[model samples]
Target: MSDTALGKDRRFPFGLTIATLIAFAILIGLGAWQIKRLAWKQDLLARIEVLKTAPAQPLATALANAQGRDLTWTRVSVDCAPAQPATLPLVYGIRDGDIVWRATALCRATVGGYGAVLLDLGVVKALTGQSAPAPVALAAPARAVGVLMAPRQLGGDREATVQKFAAERPAPYILMVETATPVPPGVTPAPLPAEISNRHLEYALTWFGLAVTLLFIYAAMLWRKMRS
Candidate 1:
């Protein structure tokens, strides 16, 4: 036989080829998905930063804009009716790199269209046997400037939540007290972060790197099989 005879008639392993192709395609798809997520995360971060710096919007105007949308971090201000406090549950806050518990309360809106809105009076360190601080006493009408946020939703218990806040219309959102004009005594503003972490880039790289490793491994296996 000619020296090239050994090279001329070897058939590729069709099954192995197909399996390798499928695996490569799936890995590539995962990598591409991560890249798309990276872009989306960047855009979300930019939007959040802009929202943070834009001038504080009036409660009414902000409410109108936030309706039927995610209004989590929009800054808003309003001259509100005195906030009555209720000790329902403990909301957490961070201080000095440690998780700290703060007392949370509901601030019912007494103004125009925003009426019935529940503003979370800023958290405090003191709690009176109910994991919540004593009720905040506000003079009849008070002015509050803060970021609007959604109240914490409990998991899988829609009926329980409906029954819990029965007396309140609980606006589509809640206010995180940033500052009370005549600052409420003992309550500290729950400062919102200027920007949130965007880790999508790192995640994307990990997924892509894994895809590349898989490609190299498949290529090596094929080369070894063909040579042997």
Candidate 2:
């Protein structure tokens, strides 16, 4: 009740503690989210590995089972007895550590989903500076074997751009050809990643470390305030 008693009474830093606690809670939540992401990434990589190495099956069979499942990088083969080819759009692709603009083509699948599928025929090599590579002649092959992939969405004017190359506007998918002989000359297949990145563990550790450091700072501040 006296002045000395009031001065001796220690008051909790309620505002500072609440703010620190909120920040700590957010950091912990982020770390937990990253952990969940880590598990998801691991599962995705495992599934991709299995699909890549699994025996090649009919394109129709793969397409049928692709519903509600990621069929990316799956090896598929089709007879494609009467394959028709048309150049899609010119896009830049990497080849042998060199950035080169490669021409992509579309092959109308007669057997599988009956949808037109895009094919990365090969790299366009220009001997003359600023000159474009000669277009590869399209040919119908007896059989086509490759990895099925989803089509990339164009940034602007999607419908017009897609329709220009893809007249049939087949299934929204493409196939990076692994082996389709007697179709085009001087065509090399584009490379795909063997494994996807899984960096969630590092991110989770960073968030957790931040939370721990915050806790230590908060504790030190409280101790100093109490002593004063």
Candidate 3:
């Protein structure tokens, strides 16, 4: 009820006590968030393990059976046998009204039947006056690993889109690879590139703990001042 109670808190004892409690709550929240992160990371690791161990299946079969589960964590690599050279209709990253570089790997099955992976190789920077990287020469049993991404129907000039042959480019049923590993004929496949963001859990704990800590400190001080 008095101006003294609402004044800018400058008293050493009170200020330090409040600040210390706030800092303690922050630290506690951080530690708890990290604990939750540990659980999430463990789950991701388990998913990766399953992808690697599960028997490789046809891309169609895999896509059809997926019951709304995140297919991005599900790694599938098909042995592609590209005969000569081909490109598939793909999404390109454009900047300043010019196509910067192709993000989608427009690829074709070399031999008869094999699945293609949308490889997310580093985008080609144009400032250096460079061109798109030459399509890698895929040898027999080419391997690729990434979560199976459902392809988008990018309806545009079928010819204007990136591809080696127009005949190969229909409404593409593409495989979206998260972190791609191209195991060309001779080389072996690499582990999935790990990328995990951890802000949600951090914020959750911070907000919840702040609410709790503020309530406690406010209650304690109210009781102290009243009793005094």
Candidate 4:
């Protein structure tokens, strides 16, 4: 066959090749990122499991020991004076398969010199039709034992929430009250999550599988072009 006719029969798939290479790189990059995520998730899960059973420490001691480290899931105890009625922020949430509101308050910490701490009093079942329940008073001081959790952004209004519950300088972590003496009225403490899902490995495999499949398809296309 003449060179001109041969070229027409088997023109290089330049555009298709470029597109395929870009897609393959993206898939591979995604897979690598997922692998890194998998490692991080595994470490977090392990830390949570250990923290769940560790004996509770005084909140002041825990804070001192943390030294700027992540305090999430660490169990601690604190004594809290009753919070002001207006400072309570009812965060929307779900618990035990029911729509509920998480009752939170900023209270004076008798120990740790924390000045104040945000206490998650617990879940208040949403009224019929998922309406928010009426706010209630926190009238009793309590000795609370709970896990310290990072404050969740309430609809991106974390700054507003902080300002609403103003204190000398509030504790950075929220104390999710597990047990308290003279429990606050009309609110149940939310339970720790029963399980945290770890699916990064599966996601990594999926991305990698797509990249390999693309390579196979590209090779087949190249074979057909060469034969033609």
Best by TM-score: 4
Better of 2 and 3 by TM-score: 2
Candidate 2 lDDT tens digits, 1-228: 676765655578888999999999999999999999999888867766686677878777877777767666778876654646644555554444566654465556653455655565555565222345554445545566777666543223333444665556555556667777565555555535433579999999999999999999999998987876
Q: CA shift at 93, candidate 2, in angstroms?
A: 5.2
The lDDT ranking, best first, is 4, 2, 1, 3
Q: Which residue runs does candidate 4 get wrong by more than 4 Å? A: 1-5, 82-87, 110-113, 126-129, 139-141, 152-159
Q: Each model's C-alpha lDDT?
A: 0.61, 0.66, 0.47, 0.76
> On residues 1-228, what C-alpha lDDT tens digit does candidate 1 reach at each position?
565875653457678778877877787787788788778778867766786677788777767765477776778887755555445544555555545444344555643354455545554545323433444443312677777665553123323433466576556566666777676566656656434566766776776787788778877977876786
Each candidate's number of clashing pairs is 0, 0, 6, 1
User: Global CA lDDT of candidate 2, please?
Assistant: 0.66
- Output the better candidate (2/4) by TM-score: 4
Per-residue lDDT of model 3, residues 157-214, tens digit only: 3234424434553223344333333423322222243344546566666666776777
Q: 115 in model 3: Cα distance from truth in Å?
A: 12
TM-score of each model, in listed order: 0.69, 0.71, 0.42, 0.85
Off by over 4 Å in 3: 1-12, 77-104, 108-117, 120-188, 193-228
**Native-to-model Cα distance after best TM-score fit, residue 228 in candidate 4, in Å:** 1.7
- Relative to the true structure, candidate 3 reaches a TM of 0.42
Please report the TM-score between candidate 1 and the true structure. 0.69
Q: What RMSD does each model have against the real structure? A: 5.6, 5.0, 9.9, 2.8
Residues 1-228, model 4: lDDT tens digits: 999999887988888899999999999999999999999989988887897688989998988778679888889988766554654656766455666777676668744556877777777644422764776555434688888887662243444666665655888777888887777666677647645789999999999999999999999999998898
